[model samples]
Target: MKLLLTSAGVNNKSIHNALTDMLGKPIASCNALCIPTAMYGHPWVGPGVNAWEFISGKSENPMVDLGWKSVGVLELTALPSISRDRWVPLVQETDVLLVSGGDALYLNHWMRQSGLAELLPALQAVYVGMSAGSMVMAPNIGEYFASWTPPGGGDEALGLVDFAIFPHLDHELLPDNTMAAAERWAAGMRGPSYAIDDQTAIKVTGGAVEIVSEGNWRHFTP
Candidate 1:
């Protein structure tokens, strides 16, 4: 699978171009499945309106709102109860997975529990993760970003990517996530990390990484 990790969604032309390049086609011809499970575990997000907004393309975060050939919802929590035949084929046919922001840990937990994490290694789909969705791909999210705790009680994630991410850098609404705070978060990462603004995105394919930005970003080394 290919990864397009964004602080926000494809908020700028550069990131949008990156997405198009990853898809190797216009988004209008691609099929998408949006995951809204992460929002339910976050205090600031929801099990209600915020989740609905994300799925229904009403959220201002700029993900599902982007035009697609078709869009469907894949709630990770519900995957466990249904047979694989019922949903696995649906996933395999989709061109991309659109993930939302909220609690990274919670998203990670569900990704594992829902069998999605295991399936990811073989999928021929692009993964476009926003905020927590992006962070879940890292080796760890750090304690600073921890919201919901998983049963294992660690800040671990899928570790699909070797580094970590400090998203929404310098976002006005999240004053504490400034560069200074990101620096502190990076120090404990023990690997490469990035502080990216809403306009920035990191693209990873075949283990190579590139920064796609139309705004501010900084690479941090531990």
Candidate 2:
């Protein structure tokens, strides 16, 4: 599977170009499945979804533009009540899974409960994770933030990626202490870890990782 874990949105023209090159088509040219509900309570959800609007040139819900045909906007405030069978077709048909930014723990909890943790890796589609979406793939979510309690229980994560990723570093848009917290957390890790600045991303393909962009990328290995 091809995975693009970006620190933020696809706001950089150069990054956008690189991503299109990597994915082999204009982002808008491909059908995208956006999980904007990942950012549930954030103010950015509206704007972030709007950004996808500009990207896809569709004023309607950006999720629709991604070719979902039927966009499922699930409110994961609690344990998922929907059956996994209902999402099977959508997951199978999507060309790209675009998980938006939000509270990492919350997103992680929902993904785990929804059974997407297992379903995503088995799919044929490309996975595009941003911010909180990126964090869920790591083995642990503690490095990214203090703690997040989902409605059902304590929030761990899906553990898709083997390493921890700290996104949105050195970006004024993030909380002032985020970077420091990540640095401290990474310092104690026993496996590979990354602290990616806002403009950067780490693309993992065929078990190899390449840090992409013009910013400081720090790696920690124990």
Candidate 3:
């Protein structure tokens, strides 16, 4: 699967271009699936207006709003009650997956439970992730970003990508997301990590990783 992991959802032209490249076609021609499951697990963004905003394309982030041929919801929590044949083909046929931000561990839990985690590696579609959606691609999000932990417990996520991410760097509302704080967060990580602002994204295709950014980002080596 192609990955376009962003601090915010396609916030800048560079990131948008990267996503286009990953899609290998125009955004208008592609079909997208929006996943809002992560929002419910977050303490601040659970089961209300935030989830509605994301699904309706009215959120501050720009995932579902990106003008696709069609946009559908793929709520992870609801997958268990349904059979795979009904939804698996729907997922495989989609051109991309627009994942929302909220809680990384929580998203990771449902991804695993919903069998999406196992299906991801073989998927032909692009996976675009915003904030915690991007963070869940990492091995672990670290304790600092942990909220709504899994029943088994820990900050561990999908581990789809080799590195970790600390999103929303230096945003006004998140007072603790400064470079210094990011450095502290990086200290506990076992592999490479990145602290990126809203205008930045990390693109991974066929095992090659690249940064597509219009704003600030810092890479830390372990």
The top-ranked prediction according to lDDT is 1
Error of 2 at 138 (Å): 0.4
The 0-to-1 C-alpha lDDT of every candidate, in the order given, reads 0.93, 0.65, 0.93
Q: Taking the tens digit of each residue's C-alpha lDDT, what string does model 3 give over 1-222?
A: 999999989878888888888888999999999999999988888789999999999998888998999999999999988999989999999999999999899899999999899999999999999999999999999999986858998788889988999999999989999999999999999899999999999999989999999999999999
- What is candidate 3's CA lDDT for residue 43? 82
If scored against the real structure, what TM-score would every candidate get? Answer: 0.98, 0.77, 0.98
Ranking by TM-score: 3, 1, 2
TM-score of 1: 0.98
TM-score for candidate 2, residues paired by index: 0.77
In candidate 3, what residue range of length 10 has the lowest lDDT sum?
A: 147-156
Error of 1 at 39 (Å): 0.5
Runs with alpha carbons beyond 4 Å of true place in candidate 1: none
Off by over 4 Å in 2: 41-85, 150-155, 175-181
What is the per-residue lDDT of model 1 for residues 94-126, given as tens digits with 9 covering 90 to 100? 999999999999999999999999989789999
Flag clash pairs in model 3: none
Each candidate's clash count = 0, 1, 0
